[model samples]
Target: MSRYLLVVPPLAGHVNPSLGLGQALVRAGHEVAWCGPELHLRPLLGAGATVFPTGSRLFRPQSDHGLAAVRSVWDRFIVPYARFSLPAVDKAIAEFRPDALVVDQHCPAGAIAAHRLGLPWATLACSTMDLGDPLAVLPRVHEWVLGRVRHIWDKAGMPADEYFDLRFSPHLVLATTSRELVGRDFPEHFRLVGPLLAERPDQPGFPAGWLRPDRRRVLVSTGTLADDVSARFLRAAVAALAPLGDRLQAVFVAPPAELPDLPEHLLAQARVPMLDLLPHLDLVVSHGGLNTVCESLAHGVPLVVAPIRHDQPINANQVEHAGAGLRIGFARAGAADIRAAVTTVLGDPGFRVAAARVAESFARAGGTGAAVAALARLTESPVTTGPSRSTS
Candidate 1:
């Protein structure tokens, strides 16, 4: 059986999309293992996922939002992260020595290491692929991101002087988002198989007894990275939804400290089993995270998005453009605007229709099956079909 090594970054949302595909590969009789951040990622990858530590630093961003965060990401997170994991990834190649590398676009060290070893590798993007395209709409950000990748590739003896879009593989680009959520006109090279809504084994369950059988249930969360601005957003959500009173109930997944102050109308938690909860939720007030957005749509739950940073603004715009939700500014979203948006999504049948439409697309996109087929085709071809070989 051919072994496929997955190179992923530390991000939970990013690694999540790979889970279903890894399971699919395993079921197909191909060996699958992980080479990602150190120890803590083990449990998250689930049982049977043989994971090797990439010797990556535990990078927690000191700045959560704004221009400072952009600078922090470049200087502190991405560049330094690439440096920290470089040797570990190369070591993984020498030790584990898989047939092909299935790499998350965020993990550049793996790509460079694969290039240095002359091994075929496919870029598995669990995030927005458009951000890393050579013809990126945000050219400056593209150049900056490539500059970081070039630094590591140059060190690894690959010619990194030229520009390369590491996000898409020449062999196969397996993306979770389809045209419905991300838009049409994606590069022909990309295989958009819709979102991988891979359910985790352990779900954080809530007190189902607390729900009033008659009320519309809504969920509020910023997904995995909520520590940055949970307080501000949670408060606004409570204020916004308070008027619903006996008519609506909002469940908030937040840190322990942020729970007590929640306006009398909401239930709060450190975390929740989102997949378990989505079916009951009529509306989701989120930070426009790609995973949450897709999951909400998958369950036919409409949304009210407050885009905080990074690709969130883009995803929120998609929700708005799709007529599935309303968008609000994270910091500037007052109680009034939040309430208005929440009411619009919850009260309107059109929003639910749009969300169900997105759900239909996700179903037809074939999730893990589509992704594995693409990988299997690339693996069987035995050609050097990946970024460095194609770009070079």
Candidate 2:
């Protein structure tokens, strides 16, 4: 048996994947603990999990698009969070004495701490952003991010000559995607373990009976994190789906506050058991988040994606390129455009066929079980001292 510590951010998308991996480790007779903000972790992890709390802060909210969004993430959140969490991570390592650490790509402090202590650690690539270097086309923007990373590295008092990108682990990298969707080759160290989808806590009181046998089922969600563009896009979605009431039923993952005047055929809720509901869905209208997109494809459900910010555009493009979905402009798409995209995905049998192909690829790549074996391998390997480069 080995002890594994997961260093993660407060955000749901980042922490959710680790839940399955951590649970699998425990089930395999290993000890697992988390290092993150307790407020968010407690609910998601339940009462039994051990957590080394890192507290919380009011970082700047990301609400921009394109290059601005990329800059906002690094300048406002990632860099500052790294500086703030480094000490806590070091402290966790001191007390827990974990055999290996599993760090998320977004939390560079975890990797830095592991390197400082000569501990074996693995990187968790939860999205497509870090995998293909998608921002390589924008040279200046890419350099700007590197500069921010250097700032954190220098502040940690590490040797300037041994500078390495802390976002990637030297030993192993677990990506929550498949090569079929990535559409590219990856390094041997990088394991494309598909989505780590464990059974999440159920969101009770969902009127499952509301789903009608006569109408096709569609789920419209922009994800948990709210943005400036989501409000307008959701309103447009409501208008688009309202007219198709007779043919299909649309369920929006929106609170009553967001849409007070929802019609009879449309349902609005603050939360729904997404994993539990995906099997029943025929089509998904999404903001192109990796989790939602992969989950939809994993269940062989087609999609109509409107990318909002960050890595969403890339994920949406991957969906379209794979022939599993269609992409529409998030900022410019109106009711007609959204309705047209949704209708096209549902009308085309080819889209469903493509989705099934992606699902098969995900199944072949394996999910939580593959990730568990990778982490176990890391724990068994010798812990190397100092900074070393791994294919990122």
Candidate 3:
């Protein structure tokens, strides 16, 4: 039996996939643990899980949309957080002394620690931000991102001559998506293991009575991280879906206080068991989060996506390219625009067919099992796959 450590961020979308992979590792008779903020990790992961707490700090929320959001992710969160968390991650490495690590792409400190100790590690790519080279179109933006990564590496005293991209591990990169949706070829090291659909904690109870047999069901969620920026979108979604309540029931994942005067057919909640709810949904109106989008497609449910920022636009484009859904402008889309997009998706049978096709591919891609197999391979060969500075 091998001991493996999972390094993840506090975000639900990032951590959820790791939880599933960790469970699969445990089921295979291997020991598993986590390194991240304990306050968030303890609740997301149950009490049974072993977590090395790195504490927490208040970084500014990613409230900006479009290009600004990308800048905030690197300047405000990724770079600073890596610096703040590096010491703790280094300490965890010393204490855990695991055979290998599965590090989230957003948490570069984990990769740095792995490189520092010459540990075998695999990159867990929960989003498409790094895979397709989205920034390649803008040479300056792409260079800026690389500059930030290099700055972090230099600060950590890593070898300047051997600079490997922190977003990818030389050993392996487990992407939580499929080729059908990616609409592009993957690198040799990338393994498209599809969505890691596993049991999650703090699953809010859903009122089964809310569903009506006569009406088709729809779920409207703009994702968890962008509550600040999503209020306007959620309000528009409520308006768009309100008129269609007689034909369909809509569930909005938002606080009741944010949206007022909801019609009888609409329900608003802060959180819901997305995994459990997806199977029952006929259509999903989302912010194009990779987890929600992949899960919806896995259930053969069509979508109307409004991309706000970061990898969301890329995911939205993929959905459109795959003929699985339509993308609307997040900031410019009003009630009518949202309604029109929703109507188009619901009216066209082709969307459902495309969604089902993606779902079939996801099933064959081997979700958690494939990821485990890849990690297992890395453990068997513990040689340093990436260049690292040696103390000796």
Candidate 4:
């Protein structure tokens, strides 16, 4: 039994996977707590878990990427986030005295703080962006990010030049997705722990019986972070599904009050426990959020991905490459394109087969259970090895 701290950002996508890991760790007889924003975390994590209010608004859910999303993430978000959170994490360290830290890769502040304290930490890769090494091919982009990491080390007042790559952990790096979804070429130091699958904390009463028994059931969501992009896609989706009439029914994740009137066959909700809803769905049309994509695959439900920003385009490309779904341009795809893509996924059995095939891999990856074991091992024997060079 050890006391472990989870350092994370307040973003829903990042926190969701960590929640699964927390749940698994607790069940395994370890004491677990978190460091992030209490306001956003309470509803998701519940009052049982202790949370330290060290989070900053360094993360934006939606960005126009006028500055380019990657550059914005490093320059505007990650660097500033780490700079401000250093003291807060120091306070937590003094009070909690955690044995090890489970840190989200995006929250470099936690990583720097853990390193300064000489505490063992594990880098949790909730998304494929880091594991895939997307920027490695671009020499200039790679150096640019490295330079930012260097600046943060100096600005945060930590031993300058002591830490260069905060994205990786010296002890261990755990990826929540399996090789089946992300492909085999991941950093050797990184362990593929699969998606930390947990039941949605906001499990709303679902109208499972309401789905028309005759029609193909579809789930339409843009994830919580994408309001504007989703609104546009929802409007287009409404038009695309209109022709199906009684042949198809769609349930949307949205604000009921803000949503425009939709067809009778379509229902809008502020939120629903996706884990609860996935079982009833034949197909999912998503904004390519990692949680939604992995959850859909875990249930053997195919997807139709329309990417908006950030890591979504890469995720969409992976889904398309895996033959689990079709990809469409988020901003450019019209109603006709939406309808055709959904129809293609539904009519073809290959898509479902592909999804099922990945589902098997997800189950075998051991998910949170394996993740817990890896983190526990870190405490028993401190890891001195550097990160693995993965070109995949």
Candidate 5:
């Protein structure tokens, strides 16, 4: 069994996919160790992998401004991550002496550490990393922001451009997203592995009186990161769907802290696993997160997406282009708009059919198990120099 060290950003969306792949690796008779914050320990351990806590920082909201929030991810999360976690990863590499390093796409520290330690490394991209065509324009924006942040890193005595270079470069890059949205010529090393989702271990009992009811069941979730903004949208959606109360049941998977006062007609719960809930769902209202989008599609549930930031808008665009969903801009969305989007999706049976077709495609693409096999191949051959392309 080869020893593998997986380093991931502490965000749930970023970490969850890696955890799914790590579990598959463990089941295949490989030893997997995850180095991240303490919050990830339980889930990583539950997945049958060893966990090493590296950074003490928790992922808290860094800004209230919309686009500024995206920049905060780099300043508060990425910069600190590179600074604090590199030493920990370097130390772990020295002692564990892993056969290969599997890192999250954004974690340049892991990739560089593996290079310095002379071990093979690969990147598991949770979202779109290839910044070409529509995405190509992002580098100029990223560079502008990095130029400002570089000074901080320089003050901290870290090589900022070196880290950025490592982050933008990868030996092999695997994205959970499909090519439907990413355009063509996406680099030979980039592989579109269908979304890596952990198979749900059975959870006991559904919400009390949570019957399928007479109307179509629509699951509304915003994922963990954007739950606050999602909650506001849910409230608007619930208000819009109030008239269709008996005709449509809206289930909002809210965080306990942000759970809004809901009308008795609409069901509200904190932290219901979407994997366990999707089978019963006819449609989903979501933020177009990669995991949520892929999971809903995997379950053959049509979507009404409200994209806020990052790759969400891109994912929403893909869903709409594929005829599986409708994308609504969150910045301009209102009760009427949310209601109209939901009605349009539910009213048209074509959306459901398209969703099912995509679901079939995703099933054929292979999920976490395929990712595990891919990693194992990397371990056996050990791409020690330059970028290696994904044959998929």
Candidate 6:
């Protein structure tokens, strides 16, 4: 059996997909080792892969300050990613001498190490990368903006153009989304492998009165990490749906301490897995996070997306244009807009049908299994030469 080294970012969304891929690799009789923060140990070990913890300050964000949070991700998150991960991954390669390296697309250090060491490597992109094409689900402008930011970051120290040139140029880019989402013709090296989600085990039972027919079950969430905007969106959704009275029941996934008073019929705060709660949901109100959007689609539930930062606006637009959901502009959407969007989706079955179709397409793309197979193939046919480097 060949050995494989998987390098993942510390965030739950990034680590979660890598965990699924690691589990599938272990099941296929490959020895896998994961490097990240200590918190990831339990989950990685549980997947039957060996774990190595690295120092990553990005794992902890100071949520009290919004701009600080964003800055911290760029500086603390991306900087250390290059500094610590390069040496750690190189050491792992020298010691364990893995047949190949499987890394998250964001971790360019791993790609660099794989290149320098002359080991085969593949990038598992969790989000859309094609930014130029109008038909692409992820807008080109967002990519341009992010690229400029990265360039500024590089000029400060690393030279962003060279980084993208060396790290992203010729690596086999394995995306978790299908071609339907990106209209551009992908290079031969880039392959669409569908969504790489962790398989759900049977979850704990829902609380009593969690689902009430008297009110529409609206799930309000912004995922785990970036939850500040979630509160604002939730407040709007509650205000919009409150008029429905017993017709709308809003379930917000958040710590109870952070929740404010809302309509008694609305479930303001609760701790629940999104996958578990989505199946019973009538409408999902969210910040257009990838996991949340994908999970909603998986359950055939329509969305009312109020996006704030990052890829959220792109995801929201995808859902809206596809007829599976509606996008309420982050700066503009108020309670009335949130309510109207939710009502429009709930009132029409066509939205749910479109969501179901995308979910079906996702299933046919082979989910995590295809990712596992791709990794396995690397073990069988290792790419000895380093990927071509380009300046762009």
Best by lDDT: 3
- How do the predictions measure up, each by TM-score? 0.91, 0.96, 0.97, 0.93, 0.86, 0.82
Where is model 4 more than 4 Å wrong at Cα?
55-61, 65-67, 226-228, 383-392
What lDDT would candidate 4 get against the real structure? 0.82
Q: Write the per-residue lDDT of candidate 2 for residues 1-392, one digit (tens) a residue.
A: 99998999887888888888888888889999999888888878778889998888888777887888888888898888898888888888888989999999989999888886678899998878777788889888778878888899999887787778877787999999999999999888898989888656544467868999998899999987576579899999999999998899989998879888888999998888888888989999998888889989999999999988888999999999999999999898999999999899889999999999999999999888898998888888786654344422
In TM-score terms, candidate 3 sits at 0.97
Encode model 4's per-residue lDDT on 177-288: one tens digit a residue.
7888887666566788778986556568877678777889998898775456667778898889988876789888887765677778888888887887788789999989
Count of residue pairs whose backbone atoms collide, per candidate = 1, 0, 0, 1, 2, 5
What is each predicted model's overall lDDT from 0 to 1? Answer: 0.76, 0.88, 0.88, 0.82, 0.72, 0.67
Worst 10 residues of 1 by lDDT: 126-135
Looking at candidate 2, the ten consecutive residues that score lowest on lDDT are 383-392
- Choose the strongest candidate by TM-score: 3
Q: What TM value does model 2 have?
A: 0.96
Give one digit per residue, the lDDT tens place, for model 5 in 1-392. Answer: 99989888777787778877877887889888887776755553464456776857665664343456556766777776777788888887877889988888667678667765557777777865223434356678667555644543464455443444454335566677666544445777666677888754433345756755677888877766554555567667767878877678887776544545665557766667667788888889888878788888888899999877766777788899989999997766888998899889999999999888888777766777667776777778856453222221
The lDDT ranking, best first, is 3, 2, 4, 1, 5, 6
Alpha carbon deviation, residue 55, candidate 4 (Å): 5.2
Q: Note the residue pairs that clash in candidate 4.
A: 176-194
User: Model 3's lDDT to the true fold?
Assistant: 0.88
lDDT over C-alpha atoms for residue 310 of model 1: 62
Which residue runs does candidate 2 get wrong by more than 4 Å? 386-392
lDDT of 6 at 42: 53
